[model samples]
Target: MDLLALETPCLILDRGKLEKNISNMHKRMKTLGVNLRPHGKTAKNIDVLKMALEDQAGGITVSTLKEAEYYFSHNIIDIVYAVGIAPVKLDRVVALIKKGARIALILDSVEQVKFVAAKGQEYDVEIPVFIELDCDGHRSGVTLDDSLLLDIGNLLHNEEGVILNGVLTHAGESYNCKSVGEIRDMAETERAMAVKCSELLRKNGLPCPIVSVGSTPTANFAEDLTGVTEVRAGVFVFNDLVMAGLGVCDESDLALSVLTSIIGHQKRKRWVITDAGWMALSRDRGTASQKVDQGAGLVCNVEGQPLNDLIVSSTNQEHGIISNRMEKDIDWDSFEIGSMVRILPNHACATGAMYDRYYITDGSTDIIDIWYRINGW
Candidate 1:
């Protein structure tokens, strides 16, 4: 297959690879017997989202209301805004709900519960609410031991227009695990925590129908998801250096990459300057703390194969400094002034977020299609 001439710094999605990654995630979730409600925040492209849900019940998790609106407009009715909502965001949620979108909102506090309940009444809409549980102190979720879980659940259950749909948590800390054993332990912890929370809600006579546990690391290694209804993982569709560093998915499984072209070079410094910079690739150095601190991203040839130890060592807003990861010698002529290069991102979601659309190809030089994305909050 011949490569197509494309604009520099465009986000590329390898179609063949994209399907393989989606299939792997769905297969894992099926074996564990849980619904694979993939997080759409990773690609933010409907083409990818459509493929991710094609083999399963269609439910997606989103990080922004704009995403909720975008997917809803595209006919994906079952959506979960995974991020906790501010009271002001209810109007946006309600507008979608009123138009036939089943958007679930997540929250963690009693104050948020009250705010959701109040907004539900004002809009006369039944807001499906998921209480966020803190599985490992990684993010915004409330801890399992907090009394507010019961308090918020009770309030939602008793409220006129609000329904306590379930509890969801992301074992984000699982990403930091150094071994498969540690990820396994964290996955068990994530499952146990959500199950225990479900038990607590049921014990309190509150309806807890859904138990959601997420984060790619925990989802991949979760030995038992017996009590969980659904698993939310986004990055698996476009594996990143961070996931590769954690052994969640290999760098070869990275379907999303930034398409760049060599613009200049510094021979003495062994740096190959490219048109892709922090703006093309995101500023998320997720692998910095990992054992392999991929400066910006791992560099690949135009065919998307790794260029030995080459990586985007540094970047300015519109320029990338690609060099050997170990800072060894470089053949400056190898990367000529107009040659194309592909840079795999440290974080797929963050990197993909930088572009408005993805140039889709199947490891070929020619573009299969261009898929648009919904960016922003």
Candidate 2:
């Protein structure tokens, strides 16, 4: 069925773009000489996972345990619960391990280290772990020159049932880099930091096996991933307005979009009101601070071709104001009250989470497939 026949404010994924993105990422990882453990936070759909992994579940990363369980339930066992593992979640991780999930946990503080160690000992199962090394201080992770990494490594490896898996770092701040050169520098820093941590652990007589590092921007621009064993990136699967703004990927590479219908119009103000609102498109103004401020998202036609100079300027709970970014005259008659439009998201992970399922297409309106996504904690 066509998307026009379906309800508005729905999610649609272009299959061609999706495959191309996956293939491009795979190729990038291949050239980087690292295993591509694509993060599953974007599309929590098993179908999307299968495509991204090319049916080979080498290793995947999840931001939430629900995603870990969902992917594990689908028989994809190797996973890294990349979020900072709270002490209370040890039981859940143990349960997942009992069910044949080789789930690795991330740790930054010594408290987390001790807690995980205690749980690993109590459960009598080897808990694979990674030290979250800080790269550029974007988010969680120990400082680059942190002396505690040695202690954390020893705590994990020396303790019974706890195996220090390796060191992992993400230069998430790489997203803010101005040019490819800056992204490359960020990627190098990320690689160097992870490698340095792993080396430190090894020097301290700890078994540090995996040296993983990546962010969509860094992974794409990095030339030397020498010591990096694996790469983890999520947003590259579905390029967004932010990625396009950073010049990492083009608008054509964007796979996911919100299908909306023109419900109302403000002729005097030249605003085309859409059924899609912040609730559907998400409130992530990731591109707002960039060179191009694509208000909520770049506006597109029914078939997924982005409309020139059109953007969702403002949004209410259930309504979106689509206007000309150039502040030119609106195409009043073209977008009839019932005419449909597609909206490319700013951040794929945030925007895709709004919908439960995605309508799959190949740039055409044909709904070739429907994939359900896992949500919640």
Predicted structure with the largest lDDT when compared to the true one: 2
Q: Find the 10 residues in a row with the least total lDDT in model 1.
A: 1-10
Q: Please provide, for model 1 over 1-377, each residue's C-alpha lDDT reduced to its tens digit, 9 standing for 90 to 100.
A: 23437878888889998899989888898899899998989888787888989654489999999888888878999999998889778889999999999999899888888888888898898999999999898878877789988988899899987998999999989878999899999999999999999999999999999999888988888888999999999999888899999998888899998889999978888899999999999899999999998989998888888988998989999999998987899877678889988999998888888889888887777787888888888
TM-score of 1: 0.97
* CA lDDT, every model vs. true structure: 0.88, 0.89
Q: List the residue pairs that clash in candidate 1.
A: 3-365, 4-365
- Count of backbone collisions within predicted model 2: 0
Q: Where does model 1 exceed 4 Å of error?
A: 1-4, 55-57
Against the true structure, candidate 2 reaches a TM-score of: 0.98
Candidate 2's C-alpha lDDT? 0.89
